[model samples]
Target: MAKIFSSSLGGSLFKDERFLYQEFVPERLPFRDEEISELVFCLKPASEGKRPTNVFVFGKPGTGKTVSLKFVLSELEEFSDRAKCLYINCFEYSSKQSIISKITNFLGYAVPSRGISYAELFSKFVAVLRTKKVLPVIVFDEAEQLLKSEETKSLLYDLARLPEQQKLSIGLAFISNDNFFLSQIDDRIRSSLQCSSIPFESYSPSELKEILRERAKYAFNEFALDEDVVPLCAAHAAKLGGDARIAIDVLLKAGRLASREGAKKVLVKHVRASFTQEKPVKVEVTSNLSEQERSILDLLKKKKSQDSGAIYDTLKDKFAERTLRAALAELEEKKLIVSEKEIKGRGFTRIVKLAGS
Candidate 1:
């Protein structure tokens, strides 16, 4: 009994932080009031049993494309009972059969384990909707992946053509990571979709700061995040293409690092440590010399100084019999190594050495 009580107490003490890293996304969609108003108008009872608007929402990752479409759908559902809404992440269901099966499953239909093709599944889905007299709004998230696959793209084309062909009211929302997703499609497929395109842009530093601040309030107690930490995180994220996901990841990592160290509040030191620890391999390679580059530098240290051609030949002989010329140029560009132009017998030879050496 005592051991059970101790285990329960330990579990309670290690509770997860309640703060949300992503803010209330519904409020941050840039210049989307016109789009929101149009969607709301489409959900009116007068438009019941009629088709909802077909929308194509595209943007770079972490630009709130999925969140905005989801926000609008949630609001529309609340405002009207005539509309039925479903959202599917296409990354999980990249194939046509898988997507159709998920749709049927979401609508409370029993998905057959096998022997059901995508076309048959879609037919049942449309039949159920027509019989129920409900205008169904289906959203495909990460839709660029679907557009890239021929079978999935053909399924979407057929679905979009349904209303015109069978006189059934069905609306589609395609959420992609870029505008080029549409351009990559067949013209006939593109024309059949004929959607009103909505563009989502990456957040600015100030915008990202505001978003982080709002999220911090929910994720941590007041005064937990230092004033400078939010701005620093925002700047870091802005430098990496204004990725909100990265901003939130940095915030979470910093906060956890602070907590693990038993600090009263998050600080720049903790943020820096977390950034360094979680840094990607490519970024780390640029930050710290990779194993191969370190080996090259060690070899360079053996010689007083060497020209590019000589270094390349030496590395090819010593290492994997591969040239080191490209690595030399990159290191020179990074200022990790220095290059000198010296007059040889004829043309100038560029000698390379460690930056300080």
Candidate 2:
């Protein structure tokens, strides 16, 4: 094993930091102070015993919608002894039954195995809340998925009406990356919700740089990271829609890669390699490429042309039991090969060529 060393010069920058870099998101959200204040006002004591507000929050991914909601709920919980706050990520618990089960579990109630509809479970949930004299505050994360499901939509409808039936103070918060959620909602349900909507926009380059700087202090030792890294990472993420998560991911990966190479500080090469490695790929297509397509493409240079089926059959001997047809289709989809179909003796055969060719 190779010995690792920290750069003497970089070691002095981030000493004795206790706060988490990515975690401990500030109570006052960065660049979202106004939205935080508005949410806080809606959850204030005057609104406690009254019917709680239905809130719809929309933003692109990494805009702090979930974190801001959690922050507001934490504050509400601290002040109100009579209210209950529950957070659910609808993407994970998408169905009504699963979401209700989670709610029951959160309340410390035994989740029944069967024989309970969403309505029944909700009624039971309200009964439990009434017995405890606690108002319910529900936050649904990834709520766009819920809006797409009829069962979830019905569940939301019932939740909105809970206050009318049981006099329970119910606040429903829906967090979504998709702005189309509002338009997809049924007219009657939409009318009943009367949800106050809030939109979270992507962070600007300066904002992303500030966030990355804050994260670096907690995630790395003082002076472990290069000064240029934060700005570069921010610029890269800005090109891809200003995703904070991607910026953090890039920073973290670059640090790890540097550490692996026994380097004292992360370099631009490390960041570039990390960014390239994280490119998304279709798993099935990548895993099952036809040997012919792979071989022919490997041999050809950019703008090179080749016969499709003939090349495919030549490679077939090397990969017995592999389907050439499927490989050609996959290659075409990937734009690695371009095929032209022409009539042969019995049927049409595609004349394949390299994409650039």
Candidate 3:
């Protein structure tokens, strides 16, 4: 084989920087200083080995809820050993067992992936905290789903009472996108949590522009992007609800598009392509339908109308005939189509037709 060599990711517009990624936690979060101080004050009690009030942080997506919380926790960990921070995204891990397992894993106890009960994991978690004498500051992002899951009452109740019953300190920080999520929570849980609530508003265009400017300094070369490029990206993302990550993404995609054409500088045209051409919206009547359902729809569009038997015969090689039948039922249930029964011979046949037919 020829000799291989590693090379730098050169001639690229980006700096391989953390500021461009959603998960990066910068040393100081700009534009969120007021909210940062409030969160720190709320979580401050935990550093003194006392339980802080549970907190509900509500905001639109990309409003810096996760970033600010992690920022304070970084400071908390650096100065003291009294509190350990654990952050979980409920959208990805919504079940009681999975959430509990996340806590356990974070605390340095690795539980097996399967064959373990949540009660067993939770008990072990409590025992570890009791032994260590350190507070576990749990931040649940996308907390709306957890509140709505069946496990909500039991899990929250047990967590709230853990401190009193066993004298263990556990703090909770819940982050949600829905403004009314807190109001929808059960009263008993609300009372038990007694959480301090904070809401984050979407960034204004100017605020988003400032944020993009800060990141661009670290993310791009000196003359890579034009002055108008950042504003165009910021304006487009602001229209999409002022998400900081979205702005960064717009810049990155636009920069790459310019680079692809060997252009020396990113421009407003590149930014527009970043918003539209890079990822065009798919306008379809079958938008929310599953792939199989959409495939069946495509077939019906080609074949006009066919009985269930003929439709299945066409798609039988792709999947089981029963699967095709299930897709037909789903389509009818979604009102994407109508099926009528008619006797063909000794058996009844259902003829399928698109909704508009």
Find the candidate with the highest TM-score and give its number: 3
Provide the global lDDT of candidate 1 against the true structure: 0.70
In order of lDDT, best first, we have 3, 2, 1
Q: Please provide TM-scores, in order, for all candidate models, with all chains considered together.
A: 0.71, 0.71, 0.75
Relative to the true structure, candidate 2 reaches a TM of 0.71
Which pairs clash in model 3?
none
lDDT of 1 at 77: 74
lDDT string for model 1 (140-236, tens) is 8878778666798788887878877888777788887656667877887778777777777777899888877766766677777778999998887
Q: Candidate 3, after superposition: displacement of residue 100 in Å?
A: 1.1
lDDT of 2 by residue, 1-357 (tens): 543543422333334333334445564456878888777766664235555667888876777888898888888888877667888988788899888778776777887969887778887777776765566678998887787667888887777666676666667888887676777788877877788888898888999998888767766787788888889999887765566876887887777677667677877888898876664443444466655666666755543655555665666677542456555555754545555558888987767675534
Expressed as tens digits, the lDDT of each residue in 45-107 for candidate 3 is 889878987888987677889888888888987767988888888878878888888888888
Worst 10 residues of 3 by lDDT: 2-11
| Residue 175 alpha-carbon offset, candidate 3, angstroms | 0.5
Give candidate 3's TM-score.
Answer: 0.75
Indicate which candidate wins on lDDT. Answer: 3
